[model samples]
Target: MIHVVFEKANVEALRKSFELDPSMDGEIAEVQDDFAVGPLADVDTEEGAAARLQWWKDILAGGHNEGLADDGHVDDQKVVRELKAKLDENPEEIVWIWAAQNKHDVSGYYWLMSQLTEYQGRIYILYLNNLPFINEKGNIFYPTNLFQIQPKEFVKAKKLARVITPSEFEVDPDEWTKLCNEDKGVRQLEGGKKLVSRGYDYYDNELLKFVTKEWQKGNKLLQQYFSKSKEITGDSYLLWRLKYLVEVGKIEMQGDWRNMKDFQVRLPGTNAEAAETTSAEASQS
Candidate 1:
């Protein structure tokens, strides 16, 4: 059996689970790239793929996530091609796709399973949607991502695996195609494999709520937003949007704007000197 997961952290979690139960051991492959956010116009076509890559390039050009390369989606395509080849080489080999309840995992599920329709019966899914699992502390809780589950809990999760039905194989791909054609910047999980499309600035107002009249460091502001906001997105994308907010004069920026830690942001017409003095006093205290 070959296991496919969406997040990189999930790859390690599965490895740990394999160690706990040797019988469930299999090769694990991660589908990189968060399809929850970004342009998905004709993503299956070569021109659309190039356009998507360029979009990522523009987002990363803002100097967020310096470690990530621009060719991740391209690499992911290669990974999928290799997975298909492996399946072709061995008909007995079955695939297991693990996903948890969240737009990131669900969107990735739609993108990946659409490509594996040819392998219909051989592909299985373990969707832990709204399912209760015991964490490290033995508390029962619902998880939003696969990485959040304890390795031991995965042994139980394996029971949730079900073969991709013929109906789903036919319907899910159409859903993906519809999403691609819609060309929306954001795909939100409404519930149970249903996605709602939204514009690129979907999170802009939420981001703005975090911005105050008093200057706040970019990194600190992002931390507060991630901790407080119910809607979560990539920090790189949020940073890019923050810069856009600055460009349009919705927010004021100071210091080196290229790096999050090196810059500070506030609402328009804020007292810069007083803000700096307050920051210095807080640091001294």
Candidate 2:
């Protein structure tokens, strides 16, 4: 068995808790660039790879350079190549994909299925986005991914994995292409059978309001507010929006902008020149 997970955090969590059998392997296929809003093709050729990389570069460099790296890009070719090699090497090995309902995992799932059009190996999916599970305290919670479920609950999910039918894979290739080309945010696939990427930002305005309220009190880190909010999925996206706010003069920072730990938010008003001039008159300590 080879478990393919959609997020790096889920992979790490599973590795720490659930040990793979001696004959099993683990792979991560998270593109980390699904927020794109253009046509994208399956990364089976050099041309497709180049196109995806260029898209990533253009989007990241356009005013979002402070949060996400100016050149931060996902190597889709490497991930696809590795998965193909593994499937070809062991045609009988089962490929178990663990994905959630969110944009990241859902997009990755569709992309992987598109790549495995001619694969002979068996493929299974553990889509636990809407399933309910009990935690250690006996309270039921609907987890987004395997990372949130208890270790013992993972065993149950493994037992419930469903094999991907030939029809499902066949229908997904065209859907995948359509989804990649859509100029919207990737969220849920329409009708649970077709994939679509009509974008939505229902949480950004609320997140900005929450952060502004918190900033009025004192300094804060990205993690501090992220841990408290359940409205957003990707932390990087929120940070990117914050950096944009800073660039537009809606917010100001006193420390290194790249490091979230050093983030100290304030409204732009006081001039640095005035503060420098008054330094001698302030307390020395």
Candidate 3:
């Protein structure tokens, strides 16, 4: 059996869960790049691929963004090719794809399924976006992603895996095309309906406020403060916004922005004329 997850956290959690589950034996893999979070362009051609990669680079010009390196650290072509090879090699193996209902997982799920449209092996999906789980306090919660799922609960989800039908492959590919070509944001709703529409960043304002309030305490470690912030979705998106703030004189940081530990942030205009100096520097750059 081969398990595919969209993020490293899910991959690590699933790997740990499988290791602890004496009855389960298999390999786990992660799509290191978060396709749901970045530029959605036609990736079938070299020009489109280059444009997509450039978009990522522009977003991270001020910081070290994940999957932005041209050296192939987060190469989509390499990852997709590897997935194809894996599917080709394991013809009879059961391929389990775990995803959630959120934009990130759903988009990733769609992109990945599109890649496997021609695959002849068995494929199963455990989409837990709407599934309820009992928490330690006996409270029911519907987690948005596999990272939030308890290790023991994973085994339960395995039983609910549904086989991907041929018709599903046909229908989903069409939806993926719209999602890639259109400006509409990719969304997978209940019953597997893919909806594309204009989307907004729901976390931006809340995260900005959080950063402003936290700066009152003193200079902050970028990753540490963000880890404490519950509203933000992921590090990449948060850092991208943080870089914008740095440019607009809202946050101040020095050194390599990619190394969150080495970087620091404080409220703008709090230190003499630093905000003005920073803005001038940003403009010059």
Candidate 4:
């Protein structure tokens, strides 16, 4: 009975709209298990939740990120038309917005959110980076479909907006976060880094392949190793582990894995700094 365009998720607008007609309160929400199938808990268990999270991570990698940004087609009018055509109903304004997968790709999905959320009941979002990202701050930088990095504060604000309107995809925020936290582990992806941390070795054998290779090639002191984490673009878990090691002083700044601020190089290393860095780099590889 209620139609919603989730693009401009401003509470003020909703308040005005509701005041105008209380019966017509609704919103187009990000695509989530709850949105399509009623509720996450009703149909998805912890294991199902974990599998869902893992699927999200795989799709949000850089290659997919860039591809969607440049080529994603978000014709709001067209979406509006399509929705009317598909649902066979036309109730009100259509919201448009892009939804990123994770906090990592929020910056990348800002512009897309606007263009996509421009229709009624069209929660158009791409599942990149394993988390949905669309927000007011995203509106600022990605104001007119421009691509660039926005801050986390902006994302938080958009989240609030969606919360009030209640994305058809709504769930217990704490429960959702818990699911994300647990599923977002080192082994979620295939053949990236072999996490050797305590109680976190989903891909222990795979991790050994790369780490042992480096060790055989003559590296040492492989504590807290991360040789097979994720395969996403610059956001790979291996790369993150490398940065983490550097932050903790497990490695220095030179050799095959020189810790240039660039931090994208991957080569062999004999020194401890290079060895650790190299190991980190190998995780992504």
What TM-scores do the predictions have?
Answer: 0.92, 0.72, 0.73, 0.24
Q: How many backbone clashes does candidate 4 have?
A: 32
Instruction: Give lDDT for model 1.
Output: 0.88
Model 2, span 1-285: residue lDDT tens: 677776667776666545643223355455455532333654445786576566545444423243243444545556667777887888675678887656567777777777777763378888875778888899999876667877667766776688887887877666667765563543554434445554445445655555542233222545556677755555545555666677877766555545555556755555554577589568574
Cα deviation of 225, candidate 2, in Å? 4.6
Worst 10 contiguous positions by lDDT, candidate 4: 188-197
Top-TM-score structure, candidate number? 1
Per-residue error at 41 for model 1, in Å? 1.0
- lDDT per model, in order? 0.88, 0.61, 0.68, 0.33
User: In terms of TM-score, which candidate is stronger, 1 or 3?
Assistant: 1
Q: Summarize candidate 1's per-residue lDDT along 137-246 as a digit string, tens digits.
A: 88999998888988899988999999999999999999998988887799899878899899999999999999999989999999999999999899888988988999
| 2 versus 4: better lDDT goes to | 2
Q: Which segments of candidate 1 are over 4 A away from where they belong?
A: 71-74, 272-285
TM-score winner between candidates 3 and 4:
3
